[model samples]
Target: MELITYWISILPELGNGVINTLIMTFLAVSMSAVLAVILAMGRMYGPRIISTLCKWYIEFFRGTPLLAQLFIIYYGLPSWGLNFSSFTSAVLAFGLNSGAYVAEYLRGAVQSIDKGQMTAGLAMGMTKFTAIRKIILPQALRFVIPPWSNDVIYTLKYTSIAFLVGAQELMSKAKIIASFNFRFIDTFVFVAIIYLILVLLLTLFFNWLERKLKIPGFEIKN
Candidate 1:
């Protein structure tokens, strides 16, 4: 009963933490998408200059630890006369970091489609941009969805790092509450359960999406 009362009392704080986590995840994922499309397409289809730049960007992020990058954004940038709010830093760092991984997934999807499709579209009077926008992207989106869903889940967990830089996300909230109660195990279990529930729901949604969007023989294995 004491535990129940404790949880009930902290419900509002935990709820807000959940909201911040969700907001961070959504914002990061949304921004990451722009990077994903740009980087994926640039590397796959653009000129050597664009492709090289994209490749380097992808390597820099993908090769480094996300926390290290977050530290640079939140801590290192202040020395250069740049400043961002903790939340903003978390969003941008996480988004850019997630984008690197997302780009590779999207690139594979884009590459899987036959090159003949682009040729056919061009022959039918479509410009390269129009052909990709119309023919390549639609099919590529279907293929990327499953893996992108995984990326979303990954982003959700990564938001826990936001707390390290003073953004009060779910993990931060849990830490605060646990510190008071000295009930670390209980607090961790509660947070873990919440995370599990969130992931389970996301997995179900992605499974349903895959079933609905999958082409007959073109079923993606992501």
Candidate 2:
């Protein structure tokens, strides 16, 4: 009860942190999703050079630790006179990092789509780009949803690291509260519960989306 009381005392500060965390997660993940779709499409259909460059980007971001990537962007960019605010740096780094992984997920989804669907669109005199835009991507996006939901959840969790880069997210605020109270365990437990609730809400939303969007013919058989 004492621990709960301590947490309650800092609710206002923590609520602000939660809002910051959500903003970071939503902006970063949303931006990453857009970039990922473009990269995935390019890798799937573009010329060799474009495809190669996309592959390299995916590998580089996925191979490195996100903390290291954040540090590099936040700390390393200042030397080139491209100093960014911590929030901007966090958003940029997280978006780029998550984009690489989302690209891979989208690439696999795009490939899993039936090749005949592309051919059929071409046979109907559709340009390749038009065919992809109208036919291929719709199917691929449907297939991507389940995995992409996981990506969204992971991205939300990863936003915790923004605190290290001075973004003042939920975890960072918890750390501050803990420092003031000298109650690391209690403060962190509150943080954990908040994160768990956020993740659960996101998961429920995705599940509902899956149900709403499921195609009768394409429904996955459990």
Candidate 3:
């Protein structure tokens, strides 16, 4: 096929870009997930000061445009004598941005559990922290999975923003290839297909996870 031939001809260049994109996306998402969990727990169980701080952080990051945030980390930080590599900047921005959203997702998940569950755990001699860890989080995590999947997909797409900051991810590579080949449409279309395939695979994997972890009487509907 013409498309196959075209892709084959440019596979080497595109492959390099794919690696960069994966690196950025995986680092960003993994860091964000960890940070998000901490923020969520703070908001849910920490003292008023910690909760307030978490709220402020969530509002600040979620309020700003991703592009603006990227610019601040990539461009604004250097004025303070703190410098980061392009890849580092991209990872930081993406992680912080995704964390804001993830925090909110987790907050909702934490709140959706019945207050009775916490009460029961307390009656059973579990401390608040232990109750949350042993009782609330497991159920909440199950409820959060669908939203978490959306966040994962969003993070994957947002990796494209790395190009603006000069991180050589997939979109950046596509731009370079386009410039050299004068084939913007072709290059972008090829990149798009690659992204589509990756997303599809992620979706399938999540679906399998959902099935594997399904609660006896509770099934997540697509």
How do these models rank on TM-score, best leading? 2, 3, 1
lDDT of 2 by residue, 59-106 (tens): 999999999999999999899888988999999998999899888988
**Better lDDT candidate (1, 3):** 1
In candidate 3, how many Å is residue 151 off?
0.6
Segments of candidate 3 deviating more than 4 angstroms = 1-3, 219-222
Q: Which residue ranges in model 1 land beyond 4 Å of their true spot?
A: 1-5
lDDT of 1 by residue, 50-91 (tens): 999999999999999999999999999999989999999999
lDDT of each: 0.92, 0.90, 0.88
Candidate 1 pairs with clashing backbones: none
TM-score, one value per model = 0.95, 0.97, 0.95
Q: Scored by Cα lDDT, where does model 3 land?
A: 0.88
Please state the error at residue 28 of candidate 3 in Å. Answer: 1.1
Give every collision pair in model 2. Answer: none
lDDT by residue (34-110, candidate 3, tens digit) is: 99989999987889999999999999999999889999998999999989998999999999999989989988978
Q: Assess the local accuracy of residue 189 in candidate 2 as a C-alpha lDDT between 0 and 100.
A: 84
User: Number of backbone collisions per candidate, in order?
Assistant: 0, 0, 0
| lDDT, model 3, position 128 | 91
Estimate the lDDT of model 1.
0.92
**Highest lDDT among the candidates is held by which one?**
1
